[model samples]
Target: MTEIHVRDLRTADPADAAAYAAVRRASVPAMPATAESVAYTCVHAHPDARYRALVAEADGEVVGTAQVGLAHDSPEPGQGYLNVYVHPERTGLGAGSLLVRTAEEFLTHEGATALYTWVLDTPRNRAFAARRGYRASRTAQFLRLDLARAALPPLADPPPGVELRTAADFRDDPRPLFALDAETAADEPSDVPAEFDDYAYWLTETWRHPLLNHELTTVAVVDGEPAAFTLAHTDGDGRYASGMTGTARAHRGRGLAKLAKNASLHRAREAGCTEAFTGNDTENGPMVAINRWFGYEVFDTEVRHVRAVG
Candidate 1:
């Protein structure tokens, strides 16, 4: 007989958290992961955000984990997410089911009316989600660039009266970047629309994230105003990720978005990062063209799944 336990991650030991991160990295290589990042998520989540990390242990060994949370920042309420991952070596011990059940109970109690999850584009993963009542939705692609070998776009000088800066420059006051983020996020394509007008939440969850590399996050400034930015993340081990790159609506046609991203990637390569990763919705044609211009190739895809719960 197998006995499984699901518990909050804040109470888990550091080794267990590390194991959880390892399983996630192995299961989804396109997504960035690290023990530090996991711990940061646990510690830095907003107080009002109902975030929980549940680990499944079979008798004496940890074998699975799930990240459950409410979409507190979305314009619509009662949106929640629960993503479950079981260790590849220990798949048949009922850990996944136990974790999913516990997560669903928590979300339901919190008044969640709908839940969204991203499942890898594989038959087994799709089948698993389908068995639990999740229906397929739009998909996104994860792209990677071999920075060590691929030729980057030639660096061009900033247009007259435009300047380039790193996110570190805004450490004292990130409100400008926050405004830009809020505007860009509102325009992003998603099943659940987000309204990132909250500055405190962005500071706690995004600006202070462990993997965020502020020094390499390039920003484009036109006439002393933030026009575009490319948020960068690095694992300090040759892997760099484009966390987000967006341009203010009024500044869309000026090529500032590409300028910011290219500047960030050059800086990342200079800092010893050899690989770059980014994700885009399949319908985001503009970003797809921009990434292709930067030599990024599609490596993997994951479909978003949604389930309605009354």
Candidate 2:
């Protein structure tokens, strides 16, 4: 076997995008990934985020990939993230270690003071992280629901003064969604805190994402205002994923979020989507319970790890 080398992704190279996507898809089957998504991410990365995508190659083949970047919007400064994934069939060939080492060197030189990553909770993966001086922080679970087989909550009419709409209805103006997403994202649990204060950034990075299905993303409006929403993404295939679901602070405890998610899921099922996926921080009891009510089952677990840098 040839030695593995980690290098920056070459977006100009067509094969690079596919290779990167292949590694990521093989490593995390539940996550949405595609060659187009990979290229879009590399080209439209937030300038303030200081993002970089790297691929590990061995024998002229891509075997691993990593996304390293600074969390510029984080209220805390010097926060960086390095989420690396090696092809399952190629593990133990040094691709993971090489990618992590290269990622650390790059981010640290970029002035990052703390680094964070999510490692699968398997014994081997956890050991690899610990050996690299990373300390476990929090856990999250990836849940999957067979849209074709699993029983979902019946769709019900919205309460008085409440109405349901799809994200497509706001194509002319998405600032209301920017406001709702920003507020809800802040309360989410994470190792590298995120703050979505820039609407323009959200537009370029999120609103225009190719995977986003505005026609299927459900929103619940109350009293003529956006109250809760469930953003949805599909791979144009039979697989669906919930990008996010949150209720405005003023509308919490009224089941608006669940209502929006249910509407979105029903739409996905009607559209022939066979599987649906979502992830939640283990500590988020409310959201976890809500997903359970929708019949999502925990399929995998990952623990966040942190390594302090200069």
- Mind giving the per-residue lDDT tens digits that candidate 2 earns over 1-310? 5788888899888789988988987898788887888889989998877899999999889999999999888999889899999999999899999999998998899899999999988999999999999999999999999999988888899999999999999999999999999999998987667888889889988899988999999899988789999999898779899999998999999999999999899889999999999999999988999999998999889999999987
Task: TM-score for candidate 1, please give it.
Answer: 0.95
| Candidate 2 overall lDDT versus native | 0.91
Q: Could you give the C-alpha RMSD of every candidate to the true structure, in order shown?
A: 1.5, 1.0
The C-alpha stretches of model 1 lying farther than 4 A from their native spots are none
TM-score of each model, paired residue for residue: 0.95, 0.98
Instruction: Evaluate residue 73 in candidate 1 and report its C-alpha lDDT on the 0 to 100 scale.
Output: 83
Which candidate leads in lDDT? 2
* lDDT per residue (tens digit) for residues 148-203 in model 1: 88799989999998899999999999999999988998888899998887788799
Residue 224, model 1: lDDT of: 82
The residue pairs that clash in candidate 2, if any, are none
The candidate 1 region of ten consecutive residues with least summed lDDT is 8-17
Pairs that clash in candidate 1: none
